[model samples]
Target: MKILIVENEIYLAQSIASKLSHFGFVCEMIPSVGEAMQMEAADIILLSANIPGQDFYPLIEKFKDSIVILMIPYVNEEMVMRPLKAGISDYIVKPFMIDELICKIEHYTAFRQLQKEIAFYRDYFCNSLLMPTYSINTKISFPLIIKSVSQKVIDMCVVNYAIHKKLAINFISLYKNHHYKEIFKSVSKTQLTYIIGFETLRKEEKEECVKALKNIPVIFACLGGDLHDFKNVFEINVKEMTHGFQEDVLSVDEYIKTMILKFEDKYPDTELSKRLGMSRKSLWEKRKKYGITKKK
Candidate 1:
């Protein structure tokens, strides 16, 4: 990473640049805020608040996007608090060890990276699951089984559960690994295990797998049909709500029925029917056939 040292003390700037360069950091030194402002962009900015007659706030604002740390002679309103409010990431006392500064740089770099990743995944999840919202059952207990017609429904339920519980999900697909049982032994107790592709296992294998997970905190996503063998099974009916097209194949009639059920309330008959590629009469007939009640 590139480091910009904006300190008026020439000797101190050279010492810091030399120490940081030894640790694989590209260091640039400038003696004033004016010169530093004109310098090229850097990943991190170490601005000394003690620069004589220079208003360091302008430099702080200029490099607000970078990890700007104040090299303060003493901690007070002008040096630490005000710069922090103005977007300086942190401050280090003078005469500090090089290792301590490196530690702060590494720490904030990881933090900023995590912020970027969170932003990306949040947008990704929002786009992937565009319609339908899910809530965890109040009576939900760990080591549960979620039975749903659509894989997407089960996925939303598990994702919502993990988020609500503030736990990370350790996803495991049975089709991909026959020895998934071994994962349970080594899995972190803090993470929630979300298991899919259980239908690929044999009857005996399913039974053994269930026994092995008896004491582990896990949620099984069983696609289609009610699983009678397991207790604490939560069924999410696909008919109750719809999320448009899905990974699972549906008959033409079923698809039409799901579409009407999902959009009937949201759109008028003329718009809804046109979108479904059918006339208002056919929409009425399909609603009748599927026994779906249209809201007044």
Candidate 2:
């Protein structure tokens, strides 16, 4: 990382540069803010706040994106607070330990990196949810429950709804073993919360979850089953099929019944039986047992 040190004290600047160079930092020393501004870009700016005749605010504005650490002679609001409020990263009192200065630099560096990463991910998540095909019903209000056969469909709907409303979503998946009681206790009343895998909870647990989330602003997406007893919650059942296969694993009988019913019109009985790895007679017997009939 490149560091620009703006200090009139030549010896102090050289000492700082020499020590930082040992740690693999590219250091450039300038006597004034004017000279510092004339230099190339730097990852960090170590600006002396007590420069006799130089105005430091211009330098701060120039390197606003860079990590700016003030080197102040004394701790006072006049020398420190104004720059800090103007977006200076941090300040160190003069004659401080080199280790302490390095520690501060590392902390702010990591913090700036974290901020960038958070911004990138926030934009990515929002852009991913902004789909033109998915439509959100704005008439429906919050504290809603969505019932769907497919979890993917529910996810798409909720995400699209959040984007439509221009509200940020705090997503919690019950499948991840999150405690419902804790989730309820910590739920944000300001932001919109989306709770997925509601059907994964037991019937008694569902009742408890419903009770806990009663007053919270949440959108519950139940992958299967219905929360019929939950009062004052708006329920939406989406019947549309998403682009992928169902997430829920089906029993052999259920799988066979669904496949036969779906493909009976598309393919003949012989082909369908062959695809299912069964004889026509066995397929017929299975269909009769499952009470599934081919529509004429």
Candidate 3:
């Protein structure tokens, strides 16, 4: 990482640079804010609070996106808290150990990386959920159950609903999580409680869960079962790519059968067979064996 140390104290600045250089970090030292402003980019900025006549706020603003650590003589509002609002990531007190400073830098680095990754995934899920997979003309209200052959279908429906309503989801997988009552009790009023793996629950557990979810913005997913007790229960069977479960491993034959059944009319036999790594004759034979009739 590239570090820009802005300090008027020449000896201290050189010492910090020398120590950090041992750790494979590229370090640059600027004596004044005027000199620091001439530079374009850096991964981190270590700005000294005691730069007599120089205003360090401009330097902080320039590298606001980078990790800016304020090096202060003492902890006070003027040196620490006030600069934080102006985009200082953290403050390290003068006379601190080098190890402590390195720890702060590493912590902020990991935190910033996590923030970027979260942002990327949020954008990805948001865009992917907006895809028009299954359309329902009837206006479906919340606090319902979706019974589907695969969990993927239920997830799509729930995510689409949450996105449409501009509400966040407090998702809990009942198969993996047993302390669901606590989660349901703690869920925010603004968020929806989306629970999956209803098939894994016992009869009494189901009754208790249903009671707990009453009159709340909730969506329950029951995979490969009939859950008709709910008032707004939707049983959806997608024939094209319907598997018993989302994570079920399909055999070679089963995979071929599913592909042919789903895409036989979409592509010609030659192209489809080539895509599936088989000859047209072999594709026809497999279709016949699987009892899948092709459309005219």
Which candidate comes out best when scored by lDDT?
1
Indicate which candidate wins on TM-score: 1
Q: Cα deviation in Å at residue 235, candidate 3?
A: 5.4
TM-score, prediction 3:
0.56
lDDT by residue (209-275, candidate 1, tens digit) is: 7777776778887653326776777877655554663455566874676576557658999999999
Worst lDDT run of 10 residues, candidate 1, spans 126-135
TM-score of 2: 0.57
Clash count for each candidate, listed in order shown: 0, 0, 0
Instruction: Assess candidate 1 and give its TM-score to the true structure.
Output: 0.65
Each candidate: what lDDT? 0.76, 0.75, 0.76
lDDT digits (tens) for residues 95-168 of candidate 3: 77889989998999999999998687557556653335533335566567787655555676777667777777
Model 2 C-alpha lDDT per residue in residues 10-40, reported as the tens digit of each score:
9999999999999899999999988888876
Model 2 lowest lDDT segment of ten: 237-246
